[model samples]
Structures are given as structure tokens and as C-alpha cells.
Target: MADKVVVFDFGGVLIDWNPDYLYRQLITDDTERRRFLTEVCSLDWITQQDGGQPIAKGTAELVARFPEHESLIRAFYERWHEMIRGVLEEGVALVDKLEAAGVPLFGLTNWSDETFPWAWERFSVLRRFRDVVVSGRVKLAKPDPAIYAEMYSRIQQQVPGVAPQDIVFIDDNVKNTRAASALGWHGVHHTSAGATEVQLRELGLAFA
Candidate 1:
């Protein structure tokens, strides 16, 4: 059997990225901040950016739509770095342990092509991954079989004998993990580092 590879999700799994962290600083009023995030910078709108829409263009269109909150809309991508608080220490430790044990590490994330650089620059742990497939770069997001297939294909090309069934995908979202599982890849619905560690152990992957 080929050596099992571990695939990680970027945002909620390894790094701590919450737009509310940035919005809280910009919008002093709690009610207004909630409203602004809901009506203006909704998750659906941001997902479009993750799906390869240029950040500048998206922000400009939002500003045009909500002229009163022009500055706030601009701040969404302007100060995007602030949204990334830091790496989740527990998750990072798991990655470190896995890497130390010689497990092949890969990443599959739904991140904006433009903003991903900021997180990539800030987190050194990301560099540990042998390869990462960014949704924005490919214009394909998770829960979609195509993105997972693309990632599998990339891994197979780089890691000679690797197969879809050899990959163990970890993600915070159940849908993404389920999709990977459906593709014959082992999937871990990551809730916590400890829980994930247990699952890996169960899979017979050793880690310090």
C-alpha cells in the first residue's frame, strides 16, 4: 500500500481567520457591525471572492452598492491581514508532529487568491505542506468533488504512487470531509486538535 498522505484545510483548521475579528475593530457599534457583515460582506459575497473574483473588483462593486459604507467595504480587503489572528497552536503542533514523523503533508483550502498571500506570509506552518491547492486559484471550492479530484491529481503527479484512497483529508466542515470520503479518501471532520490526533492514531498514523 502507498504511504497515507494527510491533507489539511487552511482557514478554520490550521489558522484562525474570522472576519469579525477585523470588523470589531472597524465598526464600534456591535449592532451595526453585525448588520454590515450580514448585509454588505455576506458569506455568499466573500465566497465569490474565494472563487477567484478579484478582491479589488468585489470591494469596488460592494462600495458602489452600499455607497454610505464605502470605507467599510474597502477595509474588508484593505486590512485583510488583520483577520488572520494566528496559527492554532494545537493544530500547528499536530502538523509539526506529522511532518516530523515523515508523513506527507498537503493542503486544500478555500481561500482568496489575492488575500491568501497575507496568511501564507504570516504562517510558516503552511510552508510545511508539500503542495496546496487553493480554491481561488482554481476557481473551485470545497464540498465540490472537482476540487478534491484536482488536489488528488496534483498529489499523484508529485508523489509517484499516491492514490485518492491513500489521502486522509481533514476539514472543519462536515460537507467537505464527506465529499472527500465519497471520493474514496479517508476523511476526518476536525473538531479539535486532540480529536483529530485520536482519529489519526486510529488510522495507524503515529505522531509525537
Candidate 2:
């Protein structure tokens, strides 16, 4: 088995973050909450922030469009910390196991530059990565070919002459993983820690 460089997606793979965590406190009605999340503050809208749009600009535009949900929209960022419950312990354990085995670890995440700092300060596990390529910081997001190319380039900066095939990227979103696979990198669609561990083990990554 070849020595592989491991790249991890932070959100679902390592950190437990969800807008619902914040919405639940703001919007009590399940149906109404679902409607607001899907229609007003949708994932598509949030992805803009994740792709480098300023949080204030995004929020202001959203509030303008949905004047009725002004308070809710404002609270999205003001109360952003509530959205992140904590690190996914199992996933962090994988990082620890890999680190213990001397595996080279890197991070690729589609997170807002404005909000990522909070996570960086809160989650010590995030600091373990040798290098982290943040989408918002780089003005690129996943599922976009450009972002994957950017990640490849960044990895090359650290590991000169490293082929894309020598990298294994783990992402919770299948679309993102598929994008990585298209770039000749081994992509693991992480559903759960146990399942991800199994796949990594098969690829010559040993974790105890």
C-alpha cells in the first residue's frame, strides 16, 4: 500500500455544525422553521458566505430580500457560535490515530472566513492539521473544480512532486468527494466515523 496524504473536510467530518442548532432556539414551530431554513436562509444562500462573500453583505442582502424575517436573518451570524455544538469526537479520534501513526494530515473546508476564526479558537483539534485550505479564505468552495485544483496546488506546495492519486480526501458531502475523485485523488464519502475508518484502513491507513 502506498503512503497516502490524508485530507479532511472539517464540518460534518470533524466538527458538528448545523444552522438548525441556532434556528431551534429562534424558531419553535418545526414546520415554520423548516420553511424559513429552506426558503429564507437556505443552504444555497449560506454557500455564498462560504465561498467568500462578506458576512455583513450576505446578511444585509438576505434581510433586504426577506424583510419579514429581518430578526431571524440578523441572528444567523450574531448567534453563529450556537450553531457549532462541538467537535465530532469520533472523527477527532481518527485524526489523533492518524497523527499518532505519523500520517500527514491536511484540512480542506468550505467555511466562511468571518466565522472560521471562532471555530479555530474553540476547536483545538483543528490546529492538528499540518496545513488547512479554507475555501472562504481562498475565495473558493467545494464541488467546484477550481477549489479542488486549488487544494491540489496547495498540497503540492508542502509535498513537492506529490501526485493527486497519492492524496485521499474525506468529505461528508458525496458531491465534494466526487469532485476530489475526479481530480485523481482517492475520495472517501464519510457517512460515519466507523465507516470512514474502514475505508481508510482498506486504503492502507492504520488506526487503532
Query: What TM-score would each prediction reach against the true structure?
Result: 0.89, 0.95
Question: Each candidate: what lDDT?
Answer: 0.90, 0.92
Q: Which candidate is the best by lDDT?
A: 2
Clashes of 1: 0
Candidate 2 regions with alpha-carbon error over 4 angstroms: none
lDDT of 2 by residue, 61-84 (tens): 999999999999999999988998
| lDDT of residue 178 for candidate 1 | 94
Clashes per candidate (backbone, < 3 Å): 0, 0
Cα lDDT tens digits for candidate 1, 1-208: 5578999998888999889899998898999999989999997788889889988888888888999999889888888888878999999999989999999899999989988887888799998898999999999888889999899888988788887778999999898899999999999999999999999888888767
Q: TM-score of model 2 relative to the true fold?
A: 0.95
